[model samples]
Target chain A: MARLAVDVMLKPEILDPQGQAIARKLPQMGFEGIAGVRQGKRFELVVEGPADEAAVERVRKIADTLLANPVIETYEVHVLSDN
Target chain B: MARLAVDVMLKPEILDPQGQAIARKLPQMGFEGIAGVRQGKRFELVVEGPADEAAVERVRKIADTLLANPVIETYEVHVLSDN
Candidate 1:
């Protein structure tokens, strides 16, 4: 089995209120010298079949279809070690 | 600058309500056959000085101090391709 690593993040231009709240509270939480902390989602899938172009397509279809909100968010894929 | 990739996620056993809601809503969004989509945060940091044991220590300290919540969450560190 191979793994497809995906990261779904809010666009930088968009205002990330959740991230902002976290960043605002970070300093008070005793986290000194930290500039910013943006939170996002990562998905690792146990994929089947040959680890080839086809696999990439299927994985990305999953991303485009359900994994990401293309309007407000974006995603990136990383094909990691396969078995 | 080198990058230290860290995955900050909710503990496995913890109730990932957000992820569960996402997984529930995914299929309806035309993402068929997606069993689950657990949500997490990945941190990529650029550090100076030597990438040695000290760097690792400093990085983990950041995790403990501000990056991760010890009580309800956990985090993992991955030293990815450095520049």
Candidate 2:
């Protein structure tokens, strides 16, 4: 079995309202010294076989087409385990 | 500056409807060979200072109390960069 982790984040130019809310709430909650916060999505996938180039490419396609919106978001794939 | 990443995932025992939907949709979308898919939240935080133990702890506290719902989710914190 193999595992792949995809991290999808808002583009640097995009505005993240959810993260802004957290930044505002943090200070109110007495947590200080945090300058910024950005919230995103993470997807963990378990593939039935080895996480080879083909498997990675497949996941990348999924990430690009389905998991993330290319206009406002970007994604990166990491192979966590391959065995 | 320092960077902290919090990954919040549904507990294994819990049912993830969103993930299930994606898993089912993947095959229909022409992506195959994936056995399971789990969706989660990833928070990227930028601290004004070093990402030491104290900073990590503060973020952990934030993650525990505000970022994640303790009932249905579990979270892990990773210090991405410290400078």
Candidate 3:
């Protein structure tokens, strides 16, 4: 089994109140010098398949289709450790 | 500054429609035998500070107070390699 991490982020042009809320709180959280905390959805999957190029493609398809809102968001996928 | 990865997930008892939807479709996407795609919010923070215990504590407070809903979600924080 392998773990996949997908981050779904809102498009730059889109307005995200949730992201805004999170960003605003960062400073208060003792990260006084930090900025730009874009909030996004994260998906961690335990896929039972060979860790191969084809597996990544399959995960990408899911990421592109149902996992993210293509109109208002962009997503990036990461393959974490395999077990 | 260090990158902090915070994964905010719904409580175990909470019915997560988004998570449910994602899991249902993952198998079709080449993860044919895998399941359990939990949907959560991710925050990548570039905090400017010494990577000290205090800094992590401060970030934790912020995560508990604003970034995550205490009643509905639980969050796990990870500090990535500093840049």
Candidate 4:
């Protein structure tokens, strides 16, 4: 089996309220020098195949269609393992 | 400024309904060879400082306390940039 990791994030123009809330709380929690906390989603997929080039490409397509909203979000896919 | 990437994932023992829902839909979407879809959270933090060892350490501490819940999730932090 192979492992793939996909990260989905809001576009730069979009607003992220959850991230905003976390940023607002940082100072209260003693982290005073941080800013722009953008929260996103990560998906770890274990596919029943080798992590070949073709597999990775197919997973990327899958990520674009099912794992992310193209209108407001973007996604990055990585093949984590070939085992 | 520097950027830090933090990935938070549920413990293996915990349930992930969102991931399961996505897995269930993949076959209908024509992705039938993938299994074990686990969903997590990703946070991109732009800190107002250099990405030095001290800054990365501080972010790790921040992740442990505020960015992730240690009770049910595990978090990994990486320094993505120094500029």
Candidate 5:
């Protein structure tokens, strides 16, 4: 089986309030020098095959159609190697 | 500036209903062979310096205390190169 990681993030143009909240709170918590922050979603999928180009493509399709909303968010898919 | 990516995930033993819901829906949507699915959070932090070890350590601390709940979730921090 192959494992794929899909990271779904809001587009750069979109405002991320959750990330803004964290960025604002960090300094108060004594963590300084952070310029900005963005929050997103991550998914791990175990598929019934090797982590090949075909598998990556399939996962990419899955990411596009189901995992992410194409209007405001984008996603990236990566293959995870067996350990 | 440097960018750091922090991934926060539920512990393996924890239940992920969102993931389960996705997994169940995928097959119904005609996507097959997905053995399992797990959902998590991803955060991108832009700091006012190079992505040095100190920055990674600082992000790790932030992730532990604020971004992730240590009881049921764990986090990984990675330094991202300027693009």
Candidate 6:
């Protein structure tokens, strides 16, 4: 089996309130020096084949169509393993 | 500046209905051969320092305390870049 990863993140221009909330709480929790934070989604897929270029392309299409909202989000696909 | 990533995922033994629902919908959406899907959280942190071991350790601690629930979830930290 092959493993692939799809990371979906909001556009840089968009406001990420969730990330902001965490950033705001960091100092209070004694975690300092964090300039910014952005929260996103990670999806791992176990597919029945080699994690080759073709598989990456297929996963990219899947990410574009289902995993990410093009209107405000973008996605990146990576092949984690081929075994 | 340094950029770090913390990926928080549910433990393997934990149930993931969100992943299941996506897996169920994949075939119907013309995406096939995906045996399983696991969804997780990805946090990107821009810190005001070098992305060294100390930064990684700090991010790991932040991940453990705030980004992930140690009871049912686990997290991994990676240094994306150091500038």
Error of 1 at B5 (Å): 4.4
lDDT of 1 by residue, B1-83 (tens): 44566677787788887778866876676555444456777665555554566656766877787667888778877665454
TM-score (C-alpha) between model 4 and the true structure: 0.95
The alpha-carbon deviation from the true structure for residue A68 of candidate 1, after best TM-score superposition, in angstroms, is: 1.0
Flag the better candidate by lDDT, 1 or 3. 3
Question: Cα deviation in Å at residue B4, candidate 4?
Answer: 0.6
Best by DockQ: 5
Candidates 2 and 3 compared by DockQ, better number:
2
TM-score of each: 0.67, 0.96, 0.73, 0.95, 0.97, 0.98
TM-score of chain A of 1: 0.88
What value does the TM-score of chain B take for model 1? Answer: 0.85
Enumerate the candidates' DockQ scores in order. 0.33, 0.91, 0.57, 0.85, 0.91, 0.91
Clash count, candidate 6? 0
How high is the lDDT of residue A56 in model 1? 76
lDDT: which is higher, 1 or 2?
2
Interface RMSD for each of the candidates: 3.4, 0.6, 2.2, 0.9, 0.5, 0.6
TM-scores for chain B, listed for all candidates? 0.85, 0.95, 0.84, 0.92, 0.95, 0.97
Highest lDDT: which candidate?
2
- Counting clashing residue pairs in each candidate, in order, gives 0, 0, 0, 0, 0, 0
For model 5, residues A22-51, the per-residue Cα lDDT tens digits are 999999999999999999999999998788
Segments of candidate 6 deviating more than 4 angstroms: none
Which pairs clash (backbone N, Cα, C closer than 3 Å) in model 2? none
Which residue pairs in candidate 3 collide?
none
Tens-place lDDT per residue, model 3, B4-79, is 7778888889888887786776656645766667788987666776656765776787788778899999998888
Off by over 4 Å in 5: none
